[model samples]
Target chain A: MLKLRWIALFLSLLLGACSQHVVLSDDFPEPIISQLPQPVVVYISPELRRYVHRHEPEQGADWTIVFGSSQEKLFKSVFAGMFEEVSLVFEEKAIPDDALVLTPVMRDFQFSTPGMSKSDYYEVWIKYSLKLARGGGEPMLNWAFTAYGREEKSGRSAAGAMREASRRAMRDAAAAIVLNFMKQPAAKKLFSVAPAAKAERT
Target chain B: MRCWPAAFALLLTAILGGCVSSSVEQLRQAPVGVLKEGETIVVLGRRQNFRHQTEADFTRCVQNTLTRKKLPVKAEQDFMDEMFPWFQPRMAPTTAEALAKRLQEPAIADRLKQTGTRYIVWLDGITRRGEDGGSLSCSVGAGGGACLGLLWWEDDAEYEAVIWDMQTLKSMGKIAVEASGTSYVPAVIIPIPLVAPTQSAACRGVANQIGEFLTKAIQ
Candidate 1:
């Protein structure tokens, strides 16, 4: 009886060993795009241009351009090509004359628009930065664009591709800026927009 | 005397065999990140600004995957409502500890402590963009490689996901993947035509690449 019991126990143990399965943690699913809108045209803010040219004299102006945009489609196409979704914020700062001169100027311009909401104008601000950097002369422009997007809800695979696209966008923008600056005429024309002068009536 | 000796040997063999088999079975059944049998694992869920429908789907997928793995999983809500009352509300660690305790089948009120969870996966962001001509490429290697390259510029979408270590709060890794091809397929249906010949191909391509990276990291 004891021997039989031992045999049964051994057989059960062996069977259990063979039947066991390896277990892994749960995997998150891929993110799905419920909707994708058409690409909106990105434009530079007029107020930003007025700010940059406010105090400068027009004697062969050296110009710099920085770009920003908030249009979802433009962001998806351009900004998404440069950053990961985890990045909640993007910022670019320019230093002129070894002092943080341009940031305050940009900051004041960013908040200056009263009619439009913050989000609507954010995209405008981003686009202006890109154009300004192209136009600014001998000007060092730092353009930082940030994005907050869908993450693992779309799965890790989707996120990886998105990050790659974002990095590419940033590189492309930088290259475009360099290429534009190499051309002297293009650079000069960027900041040639003149300030409104006081008119005297006879 | 001969029979007696044979019986003794048989009995010893059976005892040794049982021990070996039990150990093997325990090891085989162990969950990822668990070092020993009976060790507990904790499943955690994080809240983000995601669409409700998407959130439900993601939650279901994760829960199903975990259940299939046979790792005891406790929802965040259950852990909060029943397991650990002493833990401050909205605290992730407390909830993690509570869940770990449940996995171990411990006394409900006993202070169940763990080093940390095996994995923490979270969503980061999603985006889409249209591609231009400069983005397309074709190779002339073999099967169908010599076909005309299609240059389509439609908005491409991407999703970013991150995995972290629960205890140390150190980021284990991050994966960002873009939607397959340039076509916009609504999220509700599994790609139409039964198999999305192109999008499915693209999704698999991206999945394989990211999956390989993830597997290598975990191993």
Candidate 2:
């Protein structure tokens, strides 16, 4: 009995040292923006809904970070505030007629711990690619951007700090998209009204 | 009273070694105006700089101190949630001029009014520890355990707050604080710490000045 118990403990310790996994929660808040009067549709992809970052180094613990459902929630909340009428479609075929379509994909995810960086902070970097198109499959624009986040390790556990850093990186990406999207020439042409034309109309 | 002796002892010890020296200043750029009923203020800290990020606890201290002084203060997290990306670290305006431009946006302006926020204080700065020149050693044996030697360091805290009157979309004033102190840990058999509360002292000084400044601004 004693030998069996010792063997069980050793195996459990070995398993514990081999891998680490984390599931992230949603951290996005609905943004405040000047709403476009036009109706818009967002296509949420299955790949994004099941996005997971797996890291396996040569001599370190394997890490897996699951961002399930968080990305979809973020786009839903963000687009809800950006348009007068917003619709979410899980399938590409479900997009309605003549609606502006926005699709976002997670391109890459990377992170560094205190042990790796030799600093008292945990950092995460995320890359995103966003596409805007018409429901009829005509592409308007594609924008790629990167976001960085860092959290201090003073009073937080390693996992907690890394999770927070990841959330902050997502918010950074959201902020970038919100701040610059409307300023893009394509989007500007879509949303802006000429002052002379407006005056004439009024 | 017994309290007198304890207070005197504390003052003497602070005078002798571990004590904080602090200063506060305010720069008025425009005349103060009424804060008005239902209007509140928010203290926000900057985090965009790569070199340093303001301590979260320090900002909380400022908010709590302001609240303790009976000033109408809004929780920064709630305010930021309502404001969202506009007040994010990457999107937040660092200057009053930029803030004025942002306020021109109808949506943001409406959100600000809905939150009943009339004053926005941009707070920034950091605390640093340096000048370490001491050693502490401890040992335990069958006979007994003892610790001998001394460890000492210096800490400095500096902060600044830029006050903007959102109602007028102009900066009302600015407040600055600088505090420094030395902390010592000496051990004979055990460690005796004479620590300086430098950060808290700066927090109190800045909060006091802001409270007074806002009170005077009230019409």
Tens digits of lDDT, candidate 1, A20-127? 121111111111111112111222234433333121224322222222232222323332222123111122322222221122113421211112232211111212
In the range B110-170, model 2's lDDT, one tens digit per residue, is: 7788778988888888899968878999999997887767788899999998888877777
Instruction: Give all candidates' CA lDDT scores.
Output: 0.30, 0.80
Worst 10 residues of 1 chain A by lDDT: A193-202
Candidate 2, CAPRI quality class derived from DockQ: acceptable
Instruction: Encode model 2's per-residue lDDT on A84-141: one tens digit a residue.
Output: 7988999887987688899988999999988788987889999998888988587788
lDDT of 2 at A197: 11
- Per-model TM against the reference: 0.24, 0.81
* Candidate with best lDDT: 2
Q: Fraction of true contacts kept, per model?
A: 0.00, 0.71
